[model samples]
Target: MRVVIVEDNAVLAEGLNLLLASSGFEVAARTADAPSFLAAVAEHRPDVTVVDVRLPPTFSDEGVQAALAARAAVPGLPVLVFSQYVEQVYARDLLADGLGGVGYLLKDRVARVEEFLDAVRRVAAGGTAIDPEVVAQLLVRRTSPLARLTPREREVLELMAQGLDNGDIAARLVVTERAVHKHIGNIFLKLDLAPTDSGHRRVRAVLTYLDA
Candidate 1:
């Protein structure tokens, strides 16, 4: 499989390149910034991309935004986020599409080379490989009933709370109206807002989100 490495750290990027190359994977590109990473993705069309949470310029969430942009350009493009810290907002944004070809791992917690390789392969195969530590932290942070909803569903609910209709939400999210309807249905179900209830399900769902 082909791979793209997007890390500003030169030594770490080289090490990752060497490791993947030795494991029979082709290192198609090694980029240090979001713009270069997107260019590499467009040019190389690698099977998977390994990204860090921080990058050049601000060194904040550029990597996450780049990964999202690359996936937007090439839907379902697999990505494995290797970062030093667990940026909750970044993780949520990466997962907001509800696509399975994603992962987030902490740099210091990766115990072995095998584990890292396995995460790359799993994400490349359109599966999730989030680090256990990442998952635990996310779970601990979500202390409300909203935790039952997926990231995409939460986004839909938030839009609903803003009084946006299905069409408006779809337009804002760049998704089809049918998809937005499905997400609303899922939100109602997950929030336990039964169809038989006297109050409007959408209103109830929004209330739940606001309360959360």
Candidate 2:
């Protein structure tokens, strides 16, 4: 598949280009800024675009805004979004047009070459590959009951969706496992999940969130 990459970090961008090249895909164009990024799309009209959520000038959500622009410029163009952090708000925006021909994955997933390539292919073929972390993040405040969670709770929720255990989360957050457990309980209760001890709750929650 022909693809374009829009990432501000030169090292990471070059690395991804080589990876995509090695994976038997054509790198039609590469740009680190928004203008050139959009130019490449209009010039090449690639089958899929591998876009970073941040870009030059602001290093914020420029890439995301660019993808939205591309959608307007060329309807049905597939977009695969990669980000250093998982932001559900951005994911929702990208998938706002109904979740087809779009993917939102964590940049770390690029290390798993096969999965990364598969995500590209999936989005190009008109499918969604929202990271489980993103799914959980969106679910944090979606419950019927209102729970005002702190930023730390949101971080814990993001980690939890990655299938991390309480101790593992504690180590990552540099907190006690009890804190993680309390966060999980609050999340489940706020989300109005059925009372269940089975681990399938997360899975079920993810599936429901994605389908929504």
Candidate 3:
């Protein structure tokens, strides 16, 4: 897959470039600021983009804004936001479209090659790959709708938001796949998400958890 990287830190950017290259992904472009990142997006039309949450000039939220804009210009553009901290507001904005192919992960995750690559690949394949910490922070809100979920149900939802499948959730929770399905069914029912909904139930459920 072709990938574009937007990071101000030269060392980190180069490292990521090398890592993706070694993993057989083409590093189409490496940009430092929001403007350049946008330009790269238009030029390379990469299959996915790895962007930092902060960028040059302001070093505040330019990266996030650029990512949002790029997706606006190219709908469903896969974006993996790599940040040093968990900015819940930014994460919410990225997932606001309710479309998959989105990810928000802390930069620390880069140290774990396998996990990081999995997240990238997942997002590239039009899936959500939210960081566990991001999911936890969002879950703290627990507003109406979500408030009806039992504690175990909430746990299952959290893992689901982290982009884990039924098997993965089962392994993580040390439960049977059957048990995971039961909990997911309960979650959908409690959230008033019918099986016939147009969207994927798992994604819709996770969206509910995030939107809560």
In model 1, how large is the Cα lDDT of residue 159? 94
Error of 2 at 184 (Å): 24
What does candidate 3's lDDT look like per residue over 35-154, in tens digits? 989999999888999989767774556788899999988888999999885444555788778665999898875568988999999999999888787677556534466876799999
lDDT of each: 0.87, 0.76, 0.84
How do the residues 63-167 of candidate 2 rate in per-residue lDDT, one tens digit apiece?
Answer: 888988888898888998888754434556777786349988887655678899899999989987778866665666455222345667667776766878789
Per candidate, the number of residue pairs that clash is: 0, 0, 0
TM-scores for every candidate against the unseen true structure: 0.66, 0.65, 0.64
Question: Per-residue CA lDDT of candidate 1, range 1-212, in tens?
Answer: 99999999999999999999999999999999999999999999999999998787766578998999999899999999999856556677887687658999999989999999999999999999887887876676567657767999999999999999999999999999999999988776656454555358888888888887
Candidate 3 residue pairs in clash (backbone atoms < 3 Å): none
TM-score ranking, best first: 1, 2, 3
RMSD (Å) per prediction: 14.1, 11.2, 14.3
lDDT of 3 at 41: 95
In model 1, what is the error at residue 40, expressed in angstroms? 0.5
* lDDT comparison, 2 vs 3, better candidate: 3
> Which consecutive 10 residues in model 3 have the weakest lDDT in total?
190-199
